[model samples]
Target: MVVLPATLVPRLDFIPSKPHQRDGYEPEFRRGILFEIDLRTFLATLITVGSYVRIMISNLGRIGWAVVFAVLIALTIPWFLWGDGRVAYGLPVWLWWHIGWMIVVSLVFTLFANRAWGTGIEEGA
Candidate 1:
């Protein structure tokens, strides 16, 4: 979702006017590092919880995205554990294998999201 992407990826800002001699461009993200982390945590948790609640309420008869959620969890668990602190923290060769696995699983879930909830995974404009 857009909110998750915004929270996860670093934000970039543009200059007020055109190119300036003194500076090229400066990012004006939230002031501190903790601010970024805390906001991301809050946003991610809120979205995840809210989505879960919505699905349970509206689709009691229909089974939900069991496989997608399961795959996300299954892959994410070992991914963080795969690394040796500094070196493989960013999903090395084998972890990337898991990521590739997730990609395949996510496509199936995308169709499921579209069909079940009438919400396309493409999201916003």
Candidate 2:
């Protein structure tokens, strides 16, 4: 059910490997369901983290650093929700909920990717 953004060129944004694309394809379905599932999983994780950050901000009455995090999360919702058009214009409650979730989940993703790819911090170095 996760349809990538219409703006996205398949090979460029996702499924970079031809073999992965071929394996995921189904003539009847048009695309593999695995993509949708993966998207959902990532989103769900983000929302969870956002909730925690929100609580921290609420208690502290917000701060400059908190605002920075909030802005970053706001920017990311559209990026991740890219191809889910209806998702951008659904019920207000649902939209807010998902947006919040995505913020947290994305931060987690950033941390995980950095560690996995050895981006910023070098382990034991």
Candidate 3:
């Protein structure tokens, strides 16, 4: 299961208009799972995002950049440190790993924002 950050409120589960290919072209679920979406909440979200402009960033032209981030994210799980009982500076090894990982993440974000922000879009258009 792909996981999104907890802070992000994803687009609601309500499919506004497009009927499903299954379920006899109906809007309801096929497995008898009932979902309730409020009209007020839906309308509020629509208005908020109605005027939104999206910038699509694909790593098709920058495979190396994508690989770098993928490696960084994979190592963030600290699978190797699961059985670690070591302590450094009064903190567990995993905690120290996360702190250092966060620093690297921050630096990568800084580099991306400063150097690669909005790259390729203008050229493509």
Candidates sorted by TM-score, descending order? Answer: 3, 1, 2
Segments in model 3 whose C-alpha atoms lie over 4 Å from true places: 1-61, 120-125
Q: Worst lDDT window (10 residues) for model 3?
A: 1-10
After superposition, candidate 2 runs with Cα above 4 Å error: 1-3, 6-37, 62-125
- Judging by lDDT, tell me the better candidate of 2 and 3: 3
Q: Tell how far residue 123 is off in model 1, in angstroms.
A: 21
lDDT of 1 by residue, 1-109 (tens): 1222344545544312222234656555423221223556777888999999876665552434655566566766565446544435665567656677778777877
Q: Which of candidates 2 and 3 is the stronger one according to TM-score?
A: 3
Q: Which ten residues in a row have the lowest lDDT in candidate 2?
A: 116-125
Candidate 1 Cα lDDT to native: 0.53
lDDT of 3 by residue, 57-113 (tens): 344435556777899989898999999999999999999999999999999889877
Query: lDDT scores for all predictions?
Result: 0.53, 0.52, 0.64
Candidate topping TM-score? 3
